[model samples]
Target: MKLTVRSSTISEGEWDQFILAESPWAFFQSFAWGETQLLEKVAVARWEFLLDDRKIAQAQTILVKAKRGTFLHVRHGPVVNRELVNDNLLWRQILEFLAAEAKKENAWFCRIGPLLANTQETQRLFANLGVRPAPIHAMDAEYTWVLRLNEAEETILANMRKTTRYLIRQAEKQGVVVKASHQIEDFLRLYNQTAKRQRFVPHRGIEAEFAVFSKRGQAELLVASHSGQQLAAAVILYFGKQAIYHHGASIVSKISASYLLQWHAIKEAKKRGLEWYNFWGIAPEDKLEHPWQGITLFKKGFGGELRSFVHAHDLPVSPLYPVSATIEAVRKRLKHY
Candidate 1:
């Protein structure tokens, strides 16, 4: 089986459809995501791997300009077709091409976050490619939570934690309401409030993300309200077979509007006939004190299986990469990530 990689010039619909039809679950690798990156001042590109001219895999990469080191970042990507997931040679070839491209662009390294299982064979594959675990904790959602949507609504609610179900019901009885929104500002207002309260920097270009994906009918913003007061909001990315709760925010309130908001999103996903509702990232079960622990408990209460991926790996191109890695390790420790 001959394999070759080339720059992708496919139309946006075709690009997204290929991802939905052929690859693992990763909306970050979707075509609309690249456009969002571009709007955020991150240059992006897409590549397609072909098996004798038949497209088999695709990767969306961004050139991250950082003072520490400018590297090519593959955030949860190089999504391979399920059939070729076990083909080590193809994965190696893909990385070889990406690493070469990074060097040509003067990048210090090529950092990839593949959606492969955290297993022994996966370890061996990256090891053979000379990749080391990245110094930063995660490039994206390396350990995510997902709830399958094929079950009956009663069953789904029954499976959730008792407290979660109670909270959701309480919100409903208290007259909390969730509605679909086209306005990004509605979500952004709450999102910004959350970032400040949590002492974390909110990501730039969420508006751009909403615009790009919403234009394609691949996104929705859900807002939870009571007495016309916006209590909580969330942005759900509908990609592949999942409706992912990718971003969220809420004001401090005694009411359990956030819980109701999540339930609303799940029902929306089920209404849309999605296969899963992805809760995005959670702290590793082993790291009880990680930054995401609180929210992790919140997400876990909704009832879902944990999906752990091999950590992001760095394929070094320049000797400066080692220095950059050292600095990153220090920063990660300081952040407790």
Candidate 2:
């Protein structure tokens, strides 16, 4: 097999073509993510592995520069077109290419947080490649909750947990209404308040989020109100056959009626013909002490199957500067940033 690698700067058409033709993981590997990485100033690197003049594999890696050093991260990528991802020759070429790129940039190490479904066999593969699993990054975890769109709305409602369906009905009975809007003020108000309460920095200010929504056809704001008073709000993202619950918040008045608001968002997404609803992240099932106890319980009540990804893993790119990688990881962990 002949192999050659190059930095990828493909057109969006070519990129999405690859995404539509490949598995779910391929979407993340598309150039769209690389563009986002550049916009976010995350120092993105892309590589394509070709064989006998045919494009066979691609990967998109992102790096964040910190006081310690540059910390590399690959989001849900290295999308290979092969039937099985375990082929040694292909893996070897990709791994060598990544290490070389890291070295060229003087990066500390490359961390890969794949959205691929997790398994013991996959873990062993990473181990074979000299990568070690790091502690999980719960907030960045990618989750997809699937709601069947083929069934009648009533059947879909019937499949939901009793209390969930009850909440939707109650919201209707109580006259809580949901609206989709592009108004930045209202959405930001709810988003900022929720972030403060939840103890995480909001990813984007409302204006910035609106700009993102305008460019990417994937996101929207859903606000639920009672008598014109905002009670619950959600920020949803549509991407590659999935509707993701990217962010959401609620006032005390809407707590009881909030489940219905989410249900409505799911229905709206389905009506728009999206394939899946991503609840985003859930605490591990085994970790009873998870901080996400409340939210996880609520998401599970929606009746989506439990799915987990391989915990983030990293490979040493510059063996001479291992301390840089350690310090970078520590700073991110300590800051809760």
Candidate 3:
């Protein structure tokens, strides 16, 4: 079969529709995500792959330039048609195409975090292509906690940890109220405070992200307050059939307000006709010392199945890649990942 690839200037609606309808669809692969990256001064490219002129796969890659070197990051992609993904030849062609594109962009390496399950077979597939595990995650979450929203709210509550359930009830008894709004000012105030307390760098593109997603009517800010004081907040992104708990922050409070906030967000997601609620990112059980450990425990308390994606893989395209890799490796170690 003849393989061909080409860049598309217009939005590939057919491609997105097909991919988003598939299982494991992620917001990063959506057309709007590329636009959001553009607002952050990052370059994005959309490509379509064909086998005998039949569309087989598509991907949107974000080119990120750092002080050390540039790299292409493909998060939760390239969304391949189910039938083509298993075809060895198709995978080869896709990687070859990505490498060529990376070379053209002067990227030191290309990183791919496909939405495939983390299994031995999946690891071998990428390993066979000479891809190595990346030092750090390209997206915030490599493993996520996802809840199916088909069950009744009571059933959902019953499935949660007793502590989580009690906390939610306690928050209510303590007069905690969760409010959903489009305003970012209030959320940012709490977000900044959370960052300060947690000692992590806040994402610099949150404003641009909110602006883009809100314009599409696909985002909401949920804040938990008690006695007229904000205690916790989150920016939830509604994409396809899933509601993503994208960015969140909370201050130290004794009111259990965060629990109420999460429960409220889940209910809001169901109200919007969403079928899934993704509590994005959690540390693996073995990585007890990982920076996300505390929050992961908090997320797990709500009761959801753990979905582990294949770790990010790197395809080195330049000699400078090792330097960047070393820096990333050191950073990961220092962060206790």
Candidate 4:
């Protein structure tokens, strides 16, 4: 069968329908995400691959124009309908299409972080295509902890580590309150404090993120407080059947308010009839000294399956690609990611 690729200017509903129907769905590939990028002054393009007039694969590519250079990024996607025709030809055609799109967009390179499992076969496939591992991850995490949310609340609590359960109860007993709101100022205040304490740069576009997602009714800001003082805050995104713990921040306090905060988020996910609660990212087990080790331990205590996705792959489209690569390589090392 001859495969053809074309750009899409489809409605958000149409795009979402295709994305939700595929396995391993991710909000990063959703049309709303594209809109978020647009709000950040980034350009986004959606492409679809058709086999005999039937859509078989789709990707929402974002054009990230930095001071260094411009690069195309596809996060957790190029969702392909494997039941239709799962073969190398489909992927090769998709790559060729992306390369063409990159050239047209004047992008220096293209980075893809597909939702494929991190396995020898997946690595080999990208390697064979002459794609190199991205110096820095396009998404901060290539591995995540995910919990199935179909079970009853008691059963879910019973499955958690004893320590995690205890912490949640302790926070509750201490009068920790978790509240959901659409307000961004309070979350931003706490988030900035977290960035300062952690010695990391906070995402500057967070307000835009909250504004866009909340307007669409697909996001929420959950705040944890004790004695009327905020202790932690999180931004959660709901898409398809999953509720993602997209971003979080906390003050350096002795209180275990964050535990109950997370528990409340899980309950909210269940309340929304979501089938999965995704604890966005975690460090690999072997990387005991990794920067994410502390949070990884905390996430694991809640009990969930670990999912590893294929590492980000870069396909150079311009001669200037090496310069960006070199800069990112140093940045990656400095960030300890």
Candidate 5:
């Protein structure tokens, strides 16, 4: 088969068309993601793999500079054609190109969080590629909660947990309103407070995420309010065939505003003709006490099946990679996530 890898100049329409056509979709590999990364002043490289004149895959890579070491990060990629899932030669070729790019950038390693199932078969594939599991827990979601929107609205509501349904009703009775807005301030005000209150490092891309995606009408701030008082808010992104609850925050309240907020978001996603409502990352089932447990439970109440992507793998490019790995290993132990 003929193959070619095109860099950075692919048109946005061609890029998004390929991404949206993929099964399950990968927002991390979307054009908006690259734009968001650029907004943070991060270096990004976009690549498309074509075979026989047909686009077969794409990888949107980011250069992550850290005191520990700079590295190449490919989150939830390379979004590939299903037929190429086990094409070892193709994968090796892709990595070779990535490694070359990393070397040029003076990166220590290339990190790939493949968009594949987390299974023994998948593990063996990466193992054969001479890549090791990344020292850091995950660069993206390993386990996500996704609600399929193919069902009728009534059926979808009926599938929700009893308490979830009750909470939604309570929120509506309390006159809570959930509005989809482009106002970043509506999300950041609560989001910043949430970071300090929860004591977790927040991704610094909220402004960038909203600004970049909103430009394409692909993102919104879904805020929940009761009598003009903000109770909960989220920055949701519409990419591929899903609406992803990418970032969220809320204040302590008895109004169940968050519940109503998600309810409407799901409906809005369906209205947009999207096929899925992705609650993004969630704690693994076995890790009941994981830091994400509270939010995981909330996501589960809305009813969805689990989608676990394979753990990230690192392909070393420099001898100093082990030093960076050691630093990250120590960090992992201290982090509950």
Candidate 6:
């Protein structure tokens, strides 16, 4: 009946094992996400709770500081043991502890958008904790386009958009070869090239993935070659039940290789027994004329279900808070930062 809190001194490997084996919402709770956040110098706090019997009940809440106020979030979790997420007493204890931690940090709010799975009791628990469905606080929606990996390559191919299947075969006929690499340098080269070509800024936190790949087995670089020359590359991350396409690059002269590389990555994910191949994200709904149009069409060609999750939500806890949260939203729109 007692509750104990401890800092997350557990090694990355240990944390990963607990996530994969014990938590359904493993992707967000992963050490990979934590490592990424850490490399950005975002303040992170992890607390694990145990029952009187010493059984682990749950672990969660990471704080990322911002110019306005700190953001307290749960990546994919607050993984309470399945048994305890349903128990009223235990769930109450867990929420009280989390609230206290959030207040202590002077955070504006704590936000969590778990992978789309929960029981009725879990919903009730969130409601009881004053967790309302505030779409504004989510960083990324759990709803995503997913390709099932349990089927044969042929079956999977058959399910793809007609254009996607044609492009894959066309790339093969044009002598494109896709290969996997664990080298961080190779991924960086291609990623930077594409970032410049596409007129978007390159992400600053990429080195974190290199650090992770050196220590863990969650990331790989998939490259496509034409006549032995590298033409395209993608950085992919694998965790829990899903394989995610994180970043990509391609030569202007050999764009077909990009198609080949993605196809190869999906095949590899299937071989590794992953349940889903996630095409990370697309614009809110599909608009052919949007700036992200080209990429959106490419992802849709893979023929996965179109889904959308609730938007991010936040709860303010600091004394410097404004009367309305709308000011931040307006600023983002004005400056487009």
In order, the Cα lDDT scores of the candidates are 0.89, 0.70, 0.85, 0.85, 0.87, 0.69
TM-score of each: 0.95, 0.87, 0.96, 0.95, 0.95, 0.81
- Model 1 lDDT per residue over 1-337, tens place: 6678888898988888877775557678888889999888888989999998888889999998889989999987788887787787888888889999999889999998878898998888888877899998764778889999999999999999999999999999999999999989999989999999998889888899999989888899999999999999999988878998889999999999999999989998999989999999888777766788899999999998988889999999999998899999998888777
In candidate 6, stretches whose alpha carbon ends up further than 4 angstroms from where it belongs are 11-14, 54-57, 84-92, 118-128, 132-138, 196-201, 227-230, 251-254, 286-294, 306-311, 321-324, 331-337
Candidate 2 or 1, higher TM-score: 1
Error of 5 at 330 (Å): 2.1
Q: What is the descending lDDT order? A: 1, 5, 4, 3, 2, 6
Per-residue alpha-carbon lDDT of candidate 4 for residues 17-130, written as tens digits (9 for 90 to 100): 988887445678988888888888888889988988999889999988887789888887788885742366677878888988899999999988878778888777787777
RMSD in Å for model 1 = 1.6
Flag the better candidate by TM-score, 2 or 6.
2
The candidate that wins on TM-score is 3
Residue 233 shift from truth in candidate 1, angstroms = 0.7
lDDT per residue (tens digit) for residues 125-221 in model 5 = 9989998999976547677899999998899899999999999999999999998777788788898889899888877888988888888998878
Better of 2 and 3 by TM-score: 3
Candidate 2 vs candidate 4: which has greater TM-score? Answer: 4
Determine which window of 10 residues in candidate 4 has minimal summed lDDT: 82-91
Clash total of candidate 5: 0
lDDT string for model 2 (264-290, tens) is 888888888876777877766665765
Please identify model 5 stretches exceeding 4 Å from their true place: 1-3, 51-54
Stretches of candidate 2 off by over 4 Å are: 25-30, 142-144, 204-210, 254-257, 319-337
lDDT tens digits by residue: candidate 3, 46-160: 9888777877787889998999789998888887887666566678889889999999999999988778877888888887888898987435466888999998999999999
Q: What is the lDDT of candidate 5?
A: 0.87
Which prediction has more favorable lDDT, 2 or 4?
Answer: 4
Please state the error at residue 17 of candidate 3 in Å.
0.8
